[model samples]
Structures are given as structure tokens and as C-alpha cells.
Target chain A: MSEIVDWVAVDWGTSNLRAWGIGPNGAVTFKKTSPKGMGKLAREEFPAALDELLDNVAPARSGPLDVLICGMAGARQGWLEAPYLEAPTDLRGLLDGAVRPTMPDPRIAPAILPGVCQKAGADNVMRGEETQLLGLAALTPGFSGVVCMPGTHSKWAQLSGTRIEQFSTAMTGEMFEVLRTHSVLRHSLTGDLDGPGRAEGFAAGAAAGLDHPEQLLGTLFQVRAGSLLSGRQPDWCAGYLSGLLVGTEIGSNRHLIGDQPVPLIGSPALSALYAQVLAMAGARGEPMDATAIVLAGLKAARSFAA
Target chain B: MSEIVDWVAVDWGTSNLRAWGIGPNGAVTFKKTSPKGMGKLAREEFPAALDELLDNVAPARSGPLDVLICGMAGARQGWLEAPYLEAPTDLRGLLDGAVRPTMPDPRIAPAILPGVCQKAGADNVMRGEETQLLGLAALTPGFSGVVCMPGTHSKWAQLSGTRIEQFSTAMTGEMFEVLRTHSVLRHSLTGDLDGPGRAEGFAAGAAAGLDHPEQLLGTLFQVRAGSLLSGRQPDWCAGYLSGLLVGTEIGSNRHLIGDQPVPLIGSPALSALYAQVLAMAGARGEPMDATAIVLAGLKAARSFAA
Candidate 1:
């Protein structure tokens, strides 16, 4: 049976699903996304959703569908639990398989690779950031420093020459949400601190966090009690909290990173926030459009197949 | 009629209300407390509840009542809104004056004294802790150094040569409640972390918080994902969160505290936890019973009249 696509590269995570149709030349012919995030959907329903995405970008071609996927889909509850590839392994060895589900002749997108950790006392694993890193490295030539990928779990990766150095993840974004939306501190934190987090609130939060890395939790409570008992504005308290988390992340990673220029591949707003924070921490950063990096990453992976 | 008792002293806060009866000799003839905490009563009903506490204890005295009070009863919503006494001001100056509610006979209970803060760029206010500090000073002669008071709003007060030099409040305990019981992190944290936070699981969490303060939120997500994917225990996650807040408190106070020994005042269990944390942070600490401090404070305030 003839299939319709050459290669498809997909990036799926907790909240969103994205895919790109690629020609042999590494050019994207179509790109599509859906709200069916891995966090919301069941494993059995993933194939139907993926097929709908492909059908929207369906074209008349006579070839087998070749697809590469990554992200939470490689997680345990994901479509197919892609095993982790240890640190230092780039894109090639990490590919799970060319998945083809029964619902459509168009292949079910293959699960991208995940990272493994066997170190004593550390059993953490990651699935999507590695693919993003590959895409990021492919986009920027001679890019060797820290690749700051900010999200629910912000990652700080050290790329030494061509080999990936050590990396660490900070739950800065998620913690910010918990503090602002769910925690008792929420009463004191009013409105978005600034511009999808690029505001002075974010920068201030980042700076404060770095300077007073130890008081993150203790200082947060002062927001509620201070505001209620003393009439402090809710917004300032919010900004103060943002400062704690962002500042801590910047401080923790500042020493481990290099003076060499780096690339940021994630939401533009979050990427900007990270850059602003890095500057405050004495680290200079140049913004790399996350979309460009994702596309470039697909190309880099395609080069291996060719 | 010869006045049998000159006045009364009451310490009222969120969860407890306590009062002391004094004779002309400054000797406490009677003492009583009730669960009439500010948290349990309505704003309009404060006077009645306070009256009930006094009524319960006043019967022991031979004559009229002269009462001096402190804690939340001095706040805006308190009895008569006794304004705060600035730093270096003794109990006499901080007193806003006595209030005589309609139901009472001896017609006089001195107002509570409030805490004052002058730290620039930070909201400064005090409530019940000031009274506790005053109480501590009266009880302990020539005592100086830091006082670590543990509760929902934990305080670290700097005592120098019979005066409170400076103080900072940490929201450690409150944050612990929110993270463990309220936020999304609640899913990852279940059951109590063994023995009122003495279990090894809690210790491990504290260590994680100390080692990676920024990874707090990210690690918390693992509480949900870990259980969903690989069956990680939820209670351990709760303990880990406890450690983060406690660790942050220890870290924030590191520089400001410079080798001053910590005198902790709380329950045996909480004192033990604080001591454990202080040890982890390399700070020296000794537990001091709160009951002793309260008694000493009452005696000291009485001596001022002598």
C-alpha cells in the first residue's frame, strides 16, 4: 500500500500537540497543532487524533509515511513509551520506531526519543527537551554554551563542542503558577506581573530569587499576612514571588554555564523572560525564535535519515 | 472599696486567647485561656468573646479588674485598635489606652501593645509576636541573641542587651499547609509525612529543598507523574515540599544571622524539627519552652509596675 508522506516530525507535550510534514529537502510543507495534549487524552484515543491532524495536511503522494516524534508521548502514559537515551546520545540512537496505527493508512507519528539516567541517587528522566536541543543546535552554528528551554520544567543544558554536556531542570514556571494561582500567596498576587511574564514583575522576581535563593518559601507567606494585616498591594506580592523562582533558577545555573553565546528555544515570551533573567544574573543571552529551532531540529534529524 | 486587683493582661491571637490577673503587689492571682481564637470568631463578636474569657477568670479575684493585653486583640479588627508602639518604646508608651466594654464591671483592661517595623522597601508590621518577645525579655534576665518562634507564621527575632534589635517573619509553616493541603502539589503529597514531619521521607524532602531550591515545583510534578507512571509514593512528595519551605527559611536567614545562637520557643516536636534544620544549616540552636517564656514575660511586665 502506498503512503502519502515522506517524513513527519512531531513535538508533543503536556498541553499541546504539534507536527510538521517535511519533504526530502528538509522543507516543511505543512504544520499543524491540536489541543489534545498528553495530559488530557487517553492512550487509545491518541491514534485517532494523530490521524485527524495528518488528514488535515493530507496530500496525494505514493510513499510510505516516515515519522519521528518526541516529548511526553515518550512518557509512560504516552502513545508508546519511548525508552530514554542516556546523556551524550544525540538524535539518531534515540528514535523509538516508525509507528503506524490502524485507523489510517497515513502512519501514526513515531515516538521521539527520551533521555535516561542511571546515576546512583539520581533516577530522573526527560523525553522532549533532548529533541528540542537537537533542533536548537541545528539552527545555530557553533552554538555551545547553555540552551535555556523554559516551560513547566525549564531546562538548562550545557553544550560542549558538539557533545551535549550536563543539564538540569528547574520547575520555575510551574512553581510560579502554583504561587500565583493556587497557593495562599495568590490573594496578594494580583494580575499578570507583566507581558506574558516579560514584565518588570518577572525581571524583578528573577532578580530577587537569585539574590535571596534561600528564602523562596519563607518569604512567600509574608505576601498574604503582610497584605491582609498591613494592606500591601496584591500585585507587588506576586512580583516578589516571581522574583524568587526566576531569580533562583538564574542563580543556580549562572555558574554552571559558559560565557559563550547561547540559544533559547521555547515560547518567545518565556524565552525573553529567561534572557532578561540571565542578564540580571550576569549572563548575556541572544534570543533564538523557538519555532525556527523546532523546524531546524526536524531538518537536522532528517539529515540522518537521508 | 479597696481594690483587690489593679488590672489584667491578655494575649489573644488567631487560635488561642490567654489572660492574667494581677494584684497590687504585681503577683498574678489568676490565669486562664480559651479556644476563642480570632480565627474562630466573627469580627463583630470579638468584644463578647473577650468578655467571656475575662468573666471566667475575674471571679477568682477579690476586687476590680485592671487589664493590659496584647496580640491580635490590638489589630484593626481587635478590641479597640491599639496603635503600634515604635521600636525602643516600652510597654507603657505602646499602650493605646484601656477599653471598658459595656458588660464588664471593674471597667478597665489596658490595651495591647503592637510591634513596629522600620525596614525600608519591605512591609513592616507586628501582631502577637511582639507580646511573646516582651514576655521572653521579662522572663530571661540579661538574655540576648536570636529567638526562633515556630508557628503558622514563624518569627526570628534579634535580641540584643534586653532590646529587640531586629526581626524577620518566615511563612514556613503556612506555606507547608498550602503546598501539602491546597495546591496541585497536593495530589503528589498524601497522608502525613511520618511523625509530625520527623520521618525520613520529610528529611529527604528537606535535603532536596536545600540542595535544589529551584527544582521544587518541577520535582512536585513528579509527585503526580511519578505515581501515575512509575508508582512513586505521594507522602514522600509531601515531605519533600516541607523540606523546601524549611530549607528556604534556613538559607534566607543565613547572612543576617552571623553565628548568633538560636533559642527556639515552641512545642517539643517543632523545637526538635527547628533544631534539626538549624543543624543542617550549620547554625547552633537550643530549645526553650514557650510556657517558661510566657511566664517570664508576665513577671517582667509586672516588675515594670513594681
Candidate 2:
């Protein structure tokens, strides 16, 4: 496995690190993942963590393996700060800002991709998602529109062809999780964010959220009040809360989204949920395979690192 | 002191239990508090917790002390559900729906006041704040205006004279605390919420929030992005976050607020903060003492129990 491997395309995030071994023929030879994310590791430990994860994958590489990394691994607190490539730039511009971190293991050659930043109007930044957007542009040449990447900090990016003009981030996902687990609503909500979450509950909540996004403060309380006064179930309460946050996010940004079919690049369950919420607003959320897009992104970065 | 205490006015909440011993003259004779709030105590433990707090205040008593309890003690998961008194009702009517818990100690005559609920258009509920609103009504005779109570869960009520026609709860305070401590913004913010949290930061953030509260999901992320791009200080980030949330809460409900002075019933610091944010949106927030108000509410509640 080590002898055949040419390079590794890595997506290193705050809490997880995933990698794909690329063969000399430009096809994936192996796939691997590790819990050694950037969040828990110190600057000095990144090289070792990468080496350990790689050692498990291929221990006998004839030459140093080139590693092209994206995401939080390039954060200020990551292995080494990869300065942001200001937005309204082409995905191809990412390679110019790509930084190479000194590695302790001679068998590993590391290059961490720079994140995208929008410094002017609404102070905003993105780390790993920029690469995914780059991948989207690479897979679909001249792709232009809004791309929604949902996660702890869901991002909404505007791209003109292969160039990103502007982007914004919504803390909706994090808010939903915190309120569900830490606020008074926690008492009314039970169950995890796994599976479909709660379709009926989400639809009802999404309706409320979409109707009056400005009335979010009051509507949030409705989640708790619904359970207390109306005997709403735990799952329904959870779904309602989820829908409310998502609806608020989409509703707030819909003006910029227009009526175009937005590309949702994330997990199947989450993308499907976003797609459903999009239809409620008369738009379509086109799902893109996250792995395929990210891999394509890493592959694109390979050209710069190689 | 127990001999002089004719009754006890108690405000029991999720994390704290506070009692005011009332003398025969209808004045607070002594004050005492305990960590045995409804959130930590069980149904059977409420009686003992009340006894311990009362014992610390006044050990020797001649007869059974009439105890009037309000807040979470009457919640569904409380010592006993006092059942929410559906809204469009007067403060005096709260006494009519009060329920007495079966206490083992005959020395303590406990009556838990019911909360208020709005089941129509926007489902909303309030515990403890109802009594404070009652206090406001009692303190300001012929009061007919909106009251903003800031705390863990801030409540905004439309009061016509002594009756609460409608009310809504905003998870602003809880949301602020959670995002500051648990979310990505936590990494950017440092320092306790004590003292006047950065004034300059608040003024700026409040303006942004007031301008476009619909962008709350995005404005929240700026707390981190500001620190990252603009090198914002920790205290500034904290105040900015605080201001953004407070502004959003007030801004979202501004249409109903008009340009009138809202009577703010809560802690001095919190009330001042809300007052500042309200002023930003051209509305005045008149600060009222929380203790005097709640005690007044409980004192008024005493008449019904007696």
C-alpha cells in the first residue's frame, strides 16, 4: 500500500481528520481517518499526529508522501497559520496562499491550504469549507450560485463561476445544539440529532421560522411553551427547534439566495433536511456528495503541492 | 424572629430559593436564601428545603406560618404543578388559581401561585415573572404599558392596568451565556460578565443588531470573526456578543414596543444594559428594582393565601 501511494489528500477539521491516499494514476488507493483533529493538538504535535495516522495506513513508502491539507489545520492555532486568501477570488487562488509546515518526519511532506476571509462588510471567515467550494467549482466548471455548507457553523457562499465573491456564516447549528442541551428547552427536548430528527416537528417549526424570522426570540420560547402547554412530544419539540433555527437561517439569507437552486454540500441527512426546508421557500437544495467534492478539492490542491 | 413572622413570601426558581419573612405589619421581617431551587430539589425535598431556609431566618415560631410560593416551584416538574393560568387575566386572579402542596409539616402552610400562559397565536409561558408583573401593577397603580423583565429567560408582557393581556419569552440571557461559554465564540471571549462589559464594543454591536436583527444568525459569528480579523479584545468581544443578542431581542419585538419608555423589571446591571440597547433603537427602558417588585408581588399574593 505504501509503495503504490503517491500522495495524500487530507481534510483536517476542528474535531476530526480524514485522508485519502492517491495512487500514481490519480485514483484513490486507500482511505483513512483519525481523531487527531486540530482542536486538541498543539502546534508541535501536528506533525507527529499526521505521521502516526499515516504510519497506520502505509508504513513502507519509498519516498516522502506529499500531504495536501485543508480546514482548521491551517487555523491560527493550527499546525501553522496559513493566512487567509481574501474572498472575491478564484478557487485557483487557494494554491497561491497554500503554506508548507516543517515536518519532523522526513517521510511526510505537508502543505496546509489557506482559508477564505471576508474582512469588509460583515466580518466573516471560513477554514475548510473554502476547499469544498473549490472542489464544487472544479467538478462543475463555471459553477456559480450560492453554496450552503451546514455544520457547527454553517456557511453560505456566493460564487461567480470558479470565483467566490462573498460569503457569510450562520451559527444556527451550534445554537440549536446548545439550546437543546443547555437551555430551558432542554427539559422539553429529548433524543439526539441522529436519523431524520423529526419531520413533522421540523416542518411546523420551519413554517413558523420562515414566516417570522424577525420574531425568532419569541418563537424560540414557543418550543418550551408548546411542550408545557400543549403536551408536545420530545422528538417533535426537537424537530420544531431545529426547523426554527434552520428556517431562520435560510429565511434571513433568502434575499441573497434569490430563487436559484442552491447547492448543499454536507451530510446526506443534513443536506436532505436543508433541501426540504428550501422547498418550503420555493427553492431547491441540490445535494453534492461531500466526500467526492472534498476529495476533488484535495486533488486540486495536489497540483500546487506536487 | 419567627414569632414575629406572620407569613413567608417565597420566590423559588430553577437554581435558587429566596424567602422573605413577613411580619404582622405586612413588612418583610427577615430575608434568607438557599441553593435548594426547584431545579435541584425533588417533590418531597421542597418541604425540607423550605424548612431549612426558614429555620435559618427564624427558628422559633408560635403558629403555622402561611407561605406563599411563586415561580418554578409550581412548574410541572416542580414540587407540584400549579397549572398555568391561561392569559388575558388580571394579576389578582393569580391567587384564584393558586394550589397548595401537601406538606408533611403542619407548621408550614405552603401555597404555590400559578404561572401565566398565552396559547393563541404565539404560544408563550412565564413563571415567577408573572408575580413581578403583579408587583409592577401593584406598585404603579393604573399601569397600562409593556414591561420588560431581563434574567435567565427574559419576558416581555403587554399589561393593560393590572391584567396581563399577552406576553412572550426571549431566551436572550440564556443564549448569551451559552454562546459565550460553549460555542465557537467562547474561544474569542474571556472574562466574567461582571461590571459594565466593554461599552464601545456594545455600542457598535448593538447598532448592527438593531439594524438587521434578521441577520442574528450571522451577527453571532462576527463575535469570533471580529477577534480574528480586527483583533478585537476579549472584553469587547463579550460586550459585542451581549449587545448583539440584547439588541436582537429588543429589535425583533420593536414593532410592538413603539417608541415608549418600557418599564424594565430586573437586576440593576441587566436592566441598565437593556436600557442602553433600547435607547439605541429610540426606545427608553425605565429601570425598576427587582426585589421591591417581586416582594411587592409576593406581598400582594399573601392577601389571597391569607
Off by over 4 Å in 2: A1-6, A52-64, A191-197, A302-306, B1-6, B23-25, B52-64, B105-107, B191-197, B302-306
Error of 2 at B209 (Å): 1.5
Q: Write the per-residue lDDT of candidate 1 for residues B139-247, one digit (tens) a residue.
A: 6656777788876777887775457666777767876775566554576566644644335556765676656655554454444444444545665566656665676
Estimate, for each residue in B1-306, the C-alpha lDDT of model 2 and write its tens digit: 234577788999999999888876777778888888898988889888987777744423577667889999998888999978788887787887889887676777888999999896578888899999989888888888788998778999999877899988888888888888788899888765333547878888888888888889988899899989988888888888888888888888888786568999988999999999998888899999898999999887656443
TM-score of 1: 0.83
Model 2: residue A21 alpha-carbon error in angstroms: 3.2
Quality of candidate 2 docking, DockQ: 0.73
Question: Interface RMSD in Å per candidate, to 1 decimal?
Answer: 3.9, 0.8
* Candidates' RMSD to native: 4.6, 3.0
lDDT of 1 by residue, A131-182 (tens): 6677776666666777787777777777653446666666677677766776
Residue A158 in candidate 2, Cα distance off native in Å: 0.9
Best by DockQ: 2
| Residue A277 displacement (Å), model 2 | 0.6
TM-score, second chain, candidate 1: 0.82
Give the C-alpha miss distance for residue A101 in model 1, angstroms: 7.4
